[model samples]
Target: MKTIIGNDGARPVNSTKILSPVPPASTLTIDHVSIKIVCQYGKLQMAKISRSSDTAHVTYLTPEGLKEARAELEFLKNEKRAQVADRIQKARELGDVTENAEYDAALDEQTLIENRIIYLEDVLRSAKVISHPSGSDFVVIGSTVKVEMDGEVDEFTIVGKMEANPGKKRISNESPVGQALLGAKFGDVVEVSTPIVRYKVKVLQIK
Candidate 1:
């Protein structure tokens, strides 16, 4: 909304759209400047975060998990997309789109497919293929931990949220139990607290 004047005392036509005054493109470095296109949503152009972000926001995945995510994304794009498009075309032949139930359902399915494709793309982009590391000193993202609670021994792999399936002996690193177990070693007693219940777990093993 403000005018950006260059050294020549005239607004640079190409950069006038910039909301804030930026020096000439030659003066701005990759680290100093974040180019944003003036679009519908103002998407960042070629944005790159630090490595810490890559690790912190990273989705830890086994080789198998990574393969599955890619497969699902490809299937949705290559197979489901065409199917939805075909359905929509046929539904459009039925009548007006506003009153057509088949058209609406097909459109909904297309939206879901597209959304899932986007999700999978993000996931794969940020994915870190981590095999379960071998360590007995402390628990980490790829560690399988065994804990004793109330005379019962439960073993579960501590994994990122994307690959967690508690019923299959896999738990999310964000979970209370998983968070508490991280960096805990054998014979260390850790307390796990939830809104509904509180309990303690003694570390039995880590692998």
Candidate 2:
């Protein structure tokens, strides 16, 4: 058994299993601690934590994001589950499942659906809805920011990892640029570091 402590030193979390192996004395940030109930075992289990990034332990979502997640979960549990079950039933009626390709595929699809459902459930359970930043003093999650890099100005909305879509100009708060922009105020230049390149972006505006 290993005990996980919060970053704030609030309390110790006891876990019977360590999802991602780390040194016994390794310190984890608050973003790495995840507590979720396992439907299979009917017990709470600490989820795997990645060494590089936050892995959905404390999912941050905007109100719209939360609603979207809920709608998807409902569809998966209700419509998608029933559709897969029907496919399985039809496939089972065809012949022996041991050699039936349709049956095998249906079963595989069912497993994927179940896995997605579990993930969504865990995310929703641990979700923390982020509101629009109350002030423009500093960049925070849910803040729309305008920045200048390489003498070119660009705008981005800081969102959770789940809602991140670079093509859509929505960036994840955990992303290199996003992380660098966080806590930066207008007129502040912040350096974004990545393995490939490092550049500085000046915060021109925050909304």
Candidate 3:
């Protein structure tokens, strides 16, 4: 398993003292960006870090990614919305809305679902669908890149921040590795620095 020992940005000049994992709600800076982190019992939240230029309304997506998002939105709007509404209606029939536990729970679920629906709607509304820029060899979102780091050969598909899953080798464009490789070509050496560990990443190929 990979590990990261955060640096407090207070290390002596060139000092390499490694910091162990911290408690919940800890804030730190990695790559000059302010990152708010919360870790509970060693389980880290998979945060979707945004690009410096990102706007709340705009989201970049590939065709397949867009399709997936649209499908999820439809499900949430049609199925999940109906499910929660039914639960609320049934709960309301039981007794007072103020004292009913089932009613409260149903309302809470409804709020969460509606919030997500709004977010997805905004994303779809402002989405900028893009393909691999023609004749461009530089790394960009939707590009499959092969990299060598710490003697491990791996390939990663760089996608937008919304679709990045490190476990699946689909890295977010705003992530350390993805950020480093953006606009880089094959045979380029990139540095990936995180609060945990830093490594030299060499680009081998792009597709």
- What is the C-alpha lDDT profile of model 3 across 1-207, one tens digit per residue? 334455754333322333346576666656544455545334343232322223445578888889988999999998999998999899989985545789778766876787677667767877888686655688887888989999999998888877788999888888889899999998999989999998899998888
As for lDDT, the candidate ahead, 2 or 3, is: 2
Candidate 3 lDDT trough over 10 residues, lowest sum: 45-54
lDDT of 3: 0.76
lDDT tens per residue, model 2, 1-207:
455667876554546333444333333356554332222222222233322233536889999999999999999999999999999899989985545788767766876777678778777887999999866699999999999999999999999999999999999999999999999998999999999999999999999
Query: Which stretches in model 2 have alpha-carbon errors above 4 Å?
Result: 1-56
- Candidate lDDT scores, in order, read 0.75, 0.79, 0.76
Better of 1 and 2 by lDDT: 2
User: How far off is residue 126 in model 1, in Å?
Assistant: 1.0
lDDT for model 1? 0.75
Model 1 TM-score is: 0.71
Candidate 1 least-lDDT 10 residues: 38-47
What would the per-residue lDDT of candidate 1 be over residues 23-121, giving only the tens digit for each residue? 322222244332322211122212222222233456778898999999999899999999999998999899865457887787668767776776687
Off by over 4 Å in 3: 1-57, 132-135
Clashing pairs in 1: none
Which residue pairs in candidate 2 collide? none
Candidate 3 colliding pairs: 4-196
Which is better, 1 or 3, measured by TM-score?
1
TM-score of every candidate relative to the true structure: 0.71, 0.72, 0.69
